[model samples]
Target: MTDTPHTGGCRCGAVRFSAAAAPHHVSYCHCVDCRRASGAPVSAFVGFAADSVSFEGEAPRRHENGPVARSFCASCGSPIAYADSRLAADIWIMLGAMDQPAAYKPTHHAWVREQLPYVHMPDSLPRHVKSSVPRPTE
Candidate 1:
């Protein structure tokens, strides 16, 4: 955490959010659900504890599917965040929505078993078929 927060907003600027503390997890997801929702080959995220994050402007619309619930901006249909019941206290905000996307470098690749064949990332980061987030300690 620092005096200057990590900030970002929706495409339409209808939704804005900020994280005050350090992120718990930063990774790339290559699952089908993430690819379809983001309309991209892969999706990257930076996770912060729920208490350290605050949203302003319009509330994001949510899509719930079993244990997962994704939030997006209603105005421009931009993905905002991803939440899973398994990680109840953390919110994974899409890297694409971050004002400083370059600052958050993904440390690993998740759902590698479900990754598309043509999509390749040659980085030596750890790969997890089904990841158990190594929750960071304060």
Candidate 2:
């Protein structure tokens, strides 16, 4: 990964952020909660050390959803990041919110049990029936 800092924000530019380090992992999530929150069949995210990320402008509003604290832009309601107590050391940023989203790529699919029937993915990558932190080894 490039040493260049990764930067991005919400749709309205009211919530901006920068990450000091490149993501440790990136993946597509097919969990029901993620699908509903993102209004898509799946959502992609980048994992980073919790302390590596910092917010600028208006901070994202946090919504407590079970064990995960989902953050979104209060001004435009754009999904931002998620923090789970189970994975307290890391913060997962929604890939779509990144300024250069193509810089990252999904390494696997998580929560495949909830994946929509029509959603097709390559069988070569690792897939988990439920949320997989640290990823599920083959």
* Model 2 regions lying over 4 Å from their true place: 134-138
Give the Cα lDDT of each candidate: 0.89, 0.89
Residue 83 lDDT, candidate 2, scale 0-100? 90
Taking the tens digit of each residue's C-alpha lDDT, what string does model 2 give over 1-138? 575458889999999999998888888999989988889999999999999999999989999976689999999999999898777889999999999998887888899999999998766878978776753243
Candidate 1, position 47, lDDT: 90
Q: Give the Å shift of residue 41 in candidate 1.
A: 0.8
lDDT of 1 by residue, 38-76 (tens): 999999999999889999999999999977899999999
TM-score of every candidate relative to the true structure? 0.92, 0.92
Error of 2 at 87 (Å): 1.4
